[model samples]
Target: MHHTARKFSLSVTAILASLLVTLSPHTFAAVGSLDLTTSGIGYFSLVLFVIAYLLVMGEELLHLRKSKPVLVAAGIIWMLLGWVYTQEGMPHEAEHAFRHTLLEFAELMLFLLVAMTYINAMDERNVFDALRAWMIRKGFNYKTLFWLTGFLAFFISPIADNLTTALLMCAVIMKVGGEDKKFINICCINVVVAANAGGAFSPFGDITTLMVWQAGIIPFQDFFALFIPSLVNFGVPAVIMSFFIENKKPDALDEAVEMKRGAMRILALFLLTIVTAVSCHTFLHLPPVLGMMTGLGYLQFFGFFLRKTLPGSLARKRAIAESRGDQAALRRLGDVVPFDVFSKIARSEWDTLLFFYGVVMCVGGLGFMGYLALMSEVLYTGMGATVTNIILGVVSAVIDNIPVMFAVLTMQPDMSTGDWLLITLTAGVGGSMLSIGSAAGVALMGQARGMYTFIGHLKWAPVIALGYAASIAVHLWINADLFVK
Candidate 1:
């Protein structure tokens, strides 16, 4: 703890330096602020991301207390970088810049909110809450239940974020594994990896993918190209983990039907939310979040109506009913509606939001320094080849892929179908490297403590590592013709 205040001051200094560059756009030697064509801003932003990642990892590694000042200071660094550098006294575009930043944060928040909402909503139905009870009744041995639970998480994550998916699956996992800490840790590890890898391909699967789609970095159709590779992403990890996971027998199902009319109600709402989200994007040109917000609003309205229309006892009974309905199931979905769950979802450790804000502002800051814009021009000119573009896309996963993709998308270079596919695949799966690599992975660790330990994760990184590497190989090989052309 020596010179603790000094360390904080030093962190603040980096932000100020970045902010100064952002605020003074004219100072950029290249055209506009931060050389988009060729300069240091992108790399500088990478530096910031790394520092932030390290600090976060340190806190997690050491089990530090909640440090608001640390978070606040970091956020300031990111904000100033954008407000000062990117906007650069360009009063006319200030609104656009601010709006874009908000949109970015909202996109991040939307993922968390939706995941939280769905999981809590599911819990409300007494859905996953019955894992232990169901497992007990099944009479399956611990070993058999462990593998079954992992498989369940693996498949569920395509719809659920890895964290929520992992959490949902973990209820069964922990119950089956009992007090075997090592087995429990491995099971959680498998869930996290599967959920994250599964989430890589679809726009709705992961926030980064959603950002890419919504920002038009990759069109909707282009996203599905990762489908084959995403399977590999999940499959590879499952296979490796399976090698470690000895197979067990199946558990029996007991008659514990809490099914009521509310299950149908929940299903209806889930479908409605999905329908509205797609419709808004397809017809209204609304971003996913706006549509989700609309759906959430409607859910609330529906709840109010139910409270009024349904008589007291009948409503209570149905609301408490368990079922095969979606997590958005009304009545039993306690986790989503309860005040605490809602708050937790809304406030789910949004350091990354601030991190994104920092990246946006920091990238803008480089423009002020004549660093980013120039670099952009250079990259666009140099990496015009399809192969090169794919290479860059793969590299993007190592750092925050958002800025690179944004920069590339803005350049609006002539790229082909396959090259764009490569971008989607690489950027999507690249985050499997470390826990801090992806938002969902990080959130899963916090949400499921003891179950999915960070060190335990490092133990099994090879599973996902092979997945990531092999998927890229598959992407390259499958699209060989396009790359060659």
Candidate 2:
């Protein structure tokens, strides 16, 4: 199935590439440099933005040929090259600047690769399944468990990431929560909302925050000043969502019999992966991807250890062996691995990752188009830095926040400590506005299905919008004069 998907993707890419080549010179040459003073850069920007979004959406929504989107990327690149030339047009004095862009792009590519590998490796170890079962065993009744899972996804995402955290929580929800789909939906929504919200206030959380911090648009550690506001954004909705849920009592717990203590030991492995990645980023100034790849390399050693000793699995087996009544036929199914598990985990929603890559690269291409450069100069330079921060937050809610954050990072405006805090608050929490507004929100829909549907999220849009306002208000109230001088 994966190979088939790959083939289809390639085929689609070919068709898109052909169309771009045929359409390129005319469409792109005519585009020239867009002037916001006229029909507005927003128009051209929207065109570029929608095309990129269509490629992603088409890839997800339609089952076409293999490598289909790869071709689309080529055509878009053709358009981008023309726009880049017309807009930025080199330094004019024959200077070499491509090196810098490529360097930045490489770092991002690495980050994506490492993140993917780490997630796959962790799943191979069944770490997430263990975590969910433990939660169920702890007697966290439905409501508490619901909130607890989301809160964990929230905090863990800052370190683990929104996609990885959401995917992991989904497995647990599927296993213990039964076939009632709404449970999956609700759990997913809360998890994503919390994840992005928690991620907003931390430099370590979310790729977008890292991009902004790395560019020095915001100082490290100052992001937490937005924490109170960030909490308001997440806390308000979570409270509202809770009011709608039917709370039920938890099953009683027996004695504190541990689920293999060794499962906890894997936390050390997880830490090692993170530490390795961070060190590479800090010490060598390498892209986060290299670190993730290095961690993937380390997980191979972990696999050897797993083969040597199965911890929780062995005990669970022994107890099954001890049971006398209906042992024979049931034991076979229980002990043997289900093919469904293989397909589910193997077919984990990976297109989302590729979609992210395309969206970012296109956004980078749009940045090449110069209107963004103009925005920095006119809007940012004229309005003063604080309003720029607010505009950026609003922009993120309407567009893919990642690129907006990236553009803000690339521009590298001189901002007050308080102003920087506002960027953190909005870019992180602002994405809750539409389902596609944030990665966590988007992934939750795919991972959990009906619960976090776009309309469902849209229903809460007004509330999240209010939360967005409240969060900014909190930031201004708390950090007001730091904005002044």
Candidate 3:
């Protein structure tokens, strides 16, 4: 399957490349005036985008990485656009557009890199393990565990991200539920829903919200404005799902996993990093990425201290003496590896990050070609902004929200602040309507495997759709001031 997918992708790229070469002169001349909507290149760009996106959507079945087709498509589209600028004898214009795309991609990647590093550092410290151990030790009833995991996913996702939070919460559910497949399945759904919803209200939560915040379409304070609506989104489904859970208590584990040294300290530092990032963005007139990187520096310093200073501290001396086996104790300490940021970066979601790059360029190419203008007119003007934004969420469920949100951002539709918030809310939570919709849902599918399949999530789609609609309605009512304009 993988080999066949690779061959298919290469063939597509080659065909697209040949077409670009054949149409190079005409394409470049057509884009000279920045009005390609009537040109052949414009329609061609749209076709390429759709094909690339479809390949991305069928990633699982194709056994192809989502990044491959889109990356190739992005390059081809931009190359074609660049050709247009070249033929127009305005090469600088193409450079400018490419530079703009690169800049945006850099800002987003840096921000994600720092955030992911902090998350990886925390994982290295066994922070999640500590929480999981506590839950298992508590031996909570199924209903209690259900709600607890759901709410935790809701709140923690705003900081840790929805995909990671869902996976962590799923681990807890799997641990507690043991062989109860039904219990695990429902809780997984609830966690995916709650995590995605929770992520909607915070800039750090979902990629869509972050993009909106970073693009300056919405103020940082306005992100909190959706908190209530996001809560409603999660709470409604959680309440409905709670009644479906059995009340029996889970079995306690025979042993608990001990947390690594500096686990609590690392967690505290992670919180401080969040504060630093927010403060920098709110007052320092700096990008949130700067503050996050600053915080990462702090962690690196502390990691060095742990790797160098702590082992030789008086506390270690006392423990060494007590053990009467310095070599053995030293060996144990040696087993505790320091937080290596580079390794974290290597392990981070490279595919997702690369996909963002492709999506940005592809959308930028479309915008330059004026496809976005047409989309804005159709969706915002024809369908009405409210309905269009709501529909965007539904589209997000079918495809990844990252590209959907990017395309919307590129379009820069003329809408009120409330409309922007509506799109943000829908894009983030709408993915919960289907198992493959959001990263959180898709990830849980792999994590829980046979226990929580697409069919299982589909069974609960209506309940999730209810939450999706109710949350939008709630946002419309409570935050109506945003729509006043």
lDDT by candidate, in order shown: 0.53, 0.57, 0.76
Tens-place lDDT per residue, model 3, 106-166, is 6656666667666666776667777878888888899999999999999998877787788
Candidate number achieving the greatest TM-score relative to the actual structure: 3
Q: Better model by lDDT, 2 or 3? A: 3
Ranking by TM-score: 3, 2, 1
lDDT of 2: 0.57
* Candidate 2 lDDT over residue span 160-183, tens digit each: 665566666665565556656666
**TM-score for model 1?**
0.68
Top-lDDT structure, candidate number: 3
Model 1 lDDT tens row, 229-252: 777876777766765665554345
239 Cα displacement, candidate 2 (Å):
2.8
Q: What is the lDDT of residue 331 in candidate 1?
A: 40
